[model samples]
Target: MDYYNGHEDFLDRIEKLNAIGIALSSQRNAPALLEMILQGAKSILNADGGTLYLASEDKQHLIFEIIINDSLEIMMGGTTGVSIPFDPLPLYDREGKPNNNMVAAYAAINHKTINIPDAYVAEGFDFSGTRAFDRKTGYRSQSFITVPMQNHESELIGVLQLINAKDPRTGAIIPFSEQSRSLAESLASQAAIALSNNRLIQEFRQLFESFIELMAEAIDVKSPYNGKHCRRVPDLTMMIAEAVCKANYGIFKDFSMTEEELYELKIAGLLHDCGKVTTPVHVIDKATKLQTIFDRIHLIDTRFEVLKRDAEIEFLNQKLAALESGNPQNVPSLEAKFQQKIQQLNSDRTFLQKCNIGGEFMRDDLKERVLQIAKYEWVDTEGKLSPFLNENEVYNLNISRGTLTPEERQIINDHIVVTINMLTKLPYPKNLRRVPEYAGGHHERMDGKGYPKGLTREQMSVPARMMGIADIFEALSSDDRPYKDAKTLTECLQILGKMKQENHIDPDLFDLFVNEKVYLRYAEKYLHEYQIDQVDLTKIPGYTPPAV
Candidate 1:
């Protein structure tokens, strides 16, 4: 009221408007931004009430977004946690004519600002709803200004309707001046652009998330076994991270993750195994030592059949010759020798089959048996004798752990290296700059003995260490792996505890993981019912429960 003794100063309002514009442009959240826009517009004019309506996506209606009634102390939508009970106002009738009867719609449809000094006497717009509201609430509705919110291209984004401009000097209701209308129009323009930019950013985020999902789908199609690992690891990662966040007694008691930081961890978890896409599916899905495009144990079985057939042929030939030479008594010994050879061959074949099966560890004795079995000779198709097990078959059959040879294991480990290489080149936002670090560091060990970068515990972030534990736990308890049986919860925690003792994983994190029972939390969600067996904390190696 400094300018006209009863009105707001024009210069001060302009400066305030510029500041509000800056604030609007910087806000990233949609609801907060919409709420800011309405509040900013009202503050400039000291308006008593306002209700912002946005054009619906279908363009057939105006949807209420933020509603405020200062005298009644009623606020809804935006960030208020209160919802508007009103439905969207139709922009057109069922017969497809412009709905000019509604004041907000008229301003939006005509791209004109409607300035009513008093709504009770305003013409050409419906005030029946306003009258009904006033009658119900016993409050007078007066002094309206409806401004069309449009972008630089003059496309209507929404309508900003201010109610009852108050005299700064006396607090009496006054008509919105021409200056007020102009300022409101300019503010709506700025707010629209801000909203548009935020929406564009949101859409891009959605597209990026969708791309991640598509990558997951590709992995599923590439190898379903690994696909399950891909999904469950993230879940388990978050479970541990959250437990750390809520820790009340460990080294992690002071640790916490903001929403943005947790979101970064989550994205990293989702992308941790993304480079597995480049891994060969055969090597990734190798279920048995002698497995290639198919299991080679069957080939060994056929060779055993040929060896038995040869032994039978030789026995029959010798027996017939003995009978021809009038030594029929030799037939029983020949038959006994043949039967013994057949039994030995059957036993050797059975042993080789067991050796072909994969497990966590292969015994030295079993490996030596494979080597001795490899020395057995068989007739080749060209009539030349050849060793029963070729060099490659012997190597595959003698895999010391799981189904993969050292070379195949290296090929599998290269996936983490590939993940690092791929993510290092990605252009994540500043807030998510640590995604590559978190995702690629999962395979690293506390003692710098793990693969790729081999980050030590102190050299890595807590989240990366957390990811390592999650990766191990998920692999341990997961039944979907091609090489190992689904381990019980106790078994999984026992391995983690040993890893901690050996400096393969962070000790503090392992303690927290055990004390908090992050493994059981994960097991309940991802493990099979049988895998969720009784867990005894006292027996977990290198792990001690926190004192109560």
Candidate 2:
């Protein structure tokens, strides 16, 4: 019967060890995994306390990772929020000798397990620190089992030390049995493998994320006016996404996002404008209607100078002819005519200069005047008569809206299509499969009037809609854009509200943006001080204040 009972106890320990192995293999979080490994080992051996130490990168010292003592009610590290204040245990002495005096160090250095019946009577090992700890707490220190955790490569990764094994029946301190030591060694081996795998996975993820951020940085560096745009958009996107998740009384009240899903959305935000790299710098930074490689208005100014010189020369010749004909009376009228012509030339020069600049609105009369100017004849450097403005110049200067000509505007808008194509070519993992959709949908409108795909509100995802808002708001409030000044909070909100009314953006999000004051929060972090102004909710078009 005693033999059978011993057999049963051995089988029970085997089951527990098997259970611990499974748990260690499946655990993903590093801190929690380390804690579980230590706790599992302690439970199998009925140890009063245990400490897990991970080897430092240089392999010169063992750093405390998790420490737990049930009898002393002490827990540090490994998700405990309390830190281990003790210094790391050195693996080698000053002379490069293995520190075998320390049991944990000895196990790590020799890659072997050391089982001590009683630490106080143990030979050739230092217990001074352990003794000191016991003295302060008035607790007895006995029986120790130290195991070296070696990975598949046969390299020591860490050390696991259990103290004061207890007798199950008497609850008295006892030495660890051979079976307990064997089980602990097995557990430590499994834990070492799990830890190595976890670290490898974490390093790979870090590399991937770093690569993504590098690409975003590359795009941002290409345009000085887009300072931190790729970085800030993701911040704003996540801010709105989180706000929507927390909201309980809107269309997004039931919406939610998992950690992986949130990461996917963030990646989309960072890569949204990546295709802008393919856009021409001239088009992207065109600050005026006459801007190309250089502002052509300067060239037009030179032509105006030529015309004025011709007028002055013609007047002088006419006066000379009149005087030669013995008629001095016509000289004053000729001088007056020359002065009037000079003044008209100056007035035309001023008008063209104003036309060269871009504005929010270009009236039809100004466009017609630009057309008329295009018809004026001028002598070219080659002594040939040419129109004051070329066909291309007329087209550019006559643009009735922003600086971009229709062709250039189309080129700028093609970036979204390029973005979609580029993202679609990437073989994204399951969690990030919607990257193309979210990144590409930012340009789409709620009324299906948007570009690339023209996805309406009904077809678009909440994250895509959120990104649209983020993109518009960031562009509106940014002081770095070459084309426009940073608009104040009131101006940006009013424009966004008008967009909401026109079905250019998500209406529900617009309401939340006003009610929750997301604009204010974003402004505080990223907007220029002057851009942040008093926003009047009542005056903002299409925005109704949420019920108090």
Candidate 3:
């Protein structure tokens, strides 16, 4: 009957150990896992208190990771919001000798467990600090079970120390049983494996996030004008996404994002412009209509100077010919003609200079004049007559909208396609599978007229649509773009409202944007002081202020 009773108790302990192992395996958080490990050992051995110490990276010291004392009602570290102020215990003495005097350090250094029945009378180990702690707390320090936490490779990762086991029947301090020590050692081994796995997973996550940010930085570095674009877009995207999730009444009322989803969206935003790295710098930074490797306007200026010099030379030759023919009276008329020619040339030069700049709109008459200027003749370096503006130059100067020519605009727009292709090739996990779709669809429009895939508002996901609004708003209000100055908050809202009216963007989102003042919040964070102008909500086209 005695043997059977002992066997039954052993089976009960084994069942508890199995349950504890399962719990440890499921815990992904490191601090919580450590706390659980210590708690499991204490419960198994009926220990009144415990401390878990993790070995430092250098393997010379064990740092206090978690401490729990049920008798003193003390709990520090491990999500308690209370910190351990004690110093780390060293595994070795100053002379590089193993510190076998300390029970916990001895276990870590020698790869063994130290089960002391009575710490006060224990030999060959230090208990001075433990006794001091007991004196301060007016509590007796007795039995101790120190277990070394070793990984699968038998590497010492940490130490688990439990103190003052209690007799269940008498409720008196007692020595930990041989069975209790065995259970603790087993628990420590499982805890070590769990902790190691959790740390490895967390390290991989941090490395992946850091690598994403690095790629975003690399894209920004390729163009000075877009230095913070990759960073700011994610901020705005999250802002808008969060706002959508908060709307109480609308199509987005039921919208919500989990923590993982939010993280995935943020990653997508960071990588949205990554393909811009492949975009030609000349096209990306084309500040003016005539800008390429350098501002070709300077070359045009030199041509104007040549034209003036030639006119002067012709005038001097005509004056000398009039003198030789005794027809000096015609010289004044000739001089008047030369002056008029110079004046006309100066006026045309000024006009061409003005046309070289990029603006929101370019009139047809201005485009016609650019073509006319292209027909003008100039003497080339090879002494041959050439059109003052070549075919490519004329096409560039006649750009109807922003600085980019049709071909250059196509090149710039191709980044979205490249972004899709690049991201699609990546072996993303299930949670991040939508990254390519979200990143690639930011440039798509509401009316099925947008780029690459021409995805309409109905076809795109809500997060992708949110990114589109963010991208447009950021571009409109950003002072960093090379081609234009930042628009005021008022101007940006008005343009966005007009886009809604034209079905260029989601009307519902635009309404939510204005009604919620998402733009104002973003302006306070990112926009310049001058750009944050007062906006009249009533005046914004197609935007009605929400009734208070």
Candidate 4:
């Protein structure tokens, strides 16, 4: 007997179908959407079992997405997470003929609905596997309505198959009525459209992320010393941001980021250094102060060689003049003086070599010595005497800190301004409107003493502040930087804490960063074993233990 009456039940199922259709349209997740569609169709017809198979990307086969057999207490796939162990059904035979022997495949190929009174007696279709399943489970396979799911464009997306429609009053299995089958077909059409839309969205999202990562790789690759700084910074930024959200006891305990905000921050992290794309390769790759297209230290090296040669030439000339004047004793004195000059020149050359490395602070004494070396005269290849170190070379060797001169440092800092200009001009979605603000503010100091806009802590967003910390920590901890030695875990935290105290970084983020151990997580992944020396939190400048 039929369960659905052509009147009241039909109208009620129609209402459910409408509600399910609306719900299906709003679903963004793919698995949940398929579950809803299958569950919705089952609820409408009171189905005891069902299966949903979507066409593969190549459309050569129908892949098993979900299967449910309520009578046998079996529920698999979708939200239940139980995978269907069955192999995908092929859509064509070896001879290239359509596979009409399987009901689901036949529905997909023909774009038609299949209504069967009983699987055991079904004609022109193979029920051997169905009977085998029934025997193994001690169950009866009967009364199936398989509908091909197609979008509004009339493209087949999948097949929605239902089994054992039960009479509602007596719980007896019955054939699907014409009206029930019609409603099932309608539900399948809605489901197909929803699935198609989600796939399109997922593909677009994947494409956007891939493009962002590619650009980040390009920026990082531009500088050999900073190898993966662009990649590592974003990862550390997210780790810090997530720690803030999960912090049970902290200044940011009440703060939270939505999914959209998290994604926007992630995008901002990946693109924070996008402006580096416009930065000069020479400036970015400046491993030493004397480095331009090549290290100018080599030129200074040639000049040092000339100075040594000039000393030897003077010694030989003096020796020859002394001998010619019949005073060989004067030649001995001249030779000793020449040896002292050679030793002094050797010492000065070594000192200049150390200064050119640009690793440690260039003290006032060191700068004066570099200028004094510039006063030494050496004969050029053209036989003209010139200062061993030129004005520009002296200035470079006298740099107070890491590789860059003031003008080049300004050029490096200007990348943030360029980043802001580039991102601000684009039409970002409303959710991501703050990308430029977040990326641009990474260079700004908490006390308004830093770059471009000089934004103080209160003027910046939390994510921007988080980015600043991440950027600094990555640079400090990186092993490949030519300007500095590889910093240990303790050293990194010490510098970060000192920066926090100096108002160079956000205080709350610093506290959360140190106390929550986000730095440890990052170091474990990116830093070398030698750089992972035991960190003493108590000794770190701004680190305070969480209140008990």
Specify the highest-TM-score model's number: 4
TM-score of each: 0.94, 0.93, 0.92, 0.96
- Candidate 3 clashes between residue pairs 3 or more apart in a chain or in different chains: 101-126
* Tens digits of lDDT, candidate 1, 233-256: 777889988999998876776899
Superior by TM-score: candidate 3 or candidate 4 = 4
In candidate 3, stretches whose alpha carbon ends up further than 4 angstroms from where it belongs are 1-13, 168-170, 246-249, 323-332, 511-517, 544-548
* All models, RMSD in angstroms: 2.2, 2.5, 2.7, 1.8
TM-score of 2: 0.93
Q: What is candidate 3's TM-score against the reference? A: 0.92
lDDT of 4 by residue, 1-548 (tens): 45576588889999999999999988987888888988999999899989999998887799988888888888888888888899999999889899999998999999999999898888989989999988888999999999998877787799999999998888899998998889998899888888989988789778988998999999888889877988998899999989998887767768899878998999999899899998899999888889999998888888878878878888999999989999998987898999998899889988988888896577899899988989988778798888888889988889998888899999999999889998899888788899999888889999999989978888999999999999999999998887888899899899989998898999888988988889899988988989988878889997767777
| Candidate 2 ranges with C-alpha deviation above 4 Å | 1-26, 322-333
Badly placed stretches (over 4 Å) of model 4 are: 1-3
Model 4 reaches what TM-score against the true structure? 0.96
Local lDDT at 286 for model 1 = 88
Q: List the residue pairs that clash in candidate 4.
A: none
Q: How would you encode candidate 3's per-residue C-alpha lDDT over 215-304 as one tens digit per residue?
A: 999888888998888998999999988898898877777889987899899999999988897899999989889997899999998988
Candidate 4 lDDT score relative to the true structure? 0.89
Q: What lDDT would each prediction earn against the true structure? A: 0.88, 0.90, 0.89, 0.89
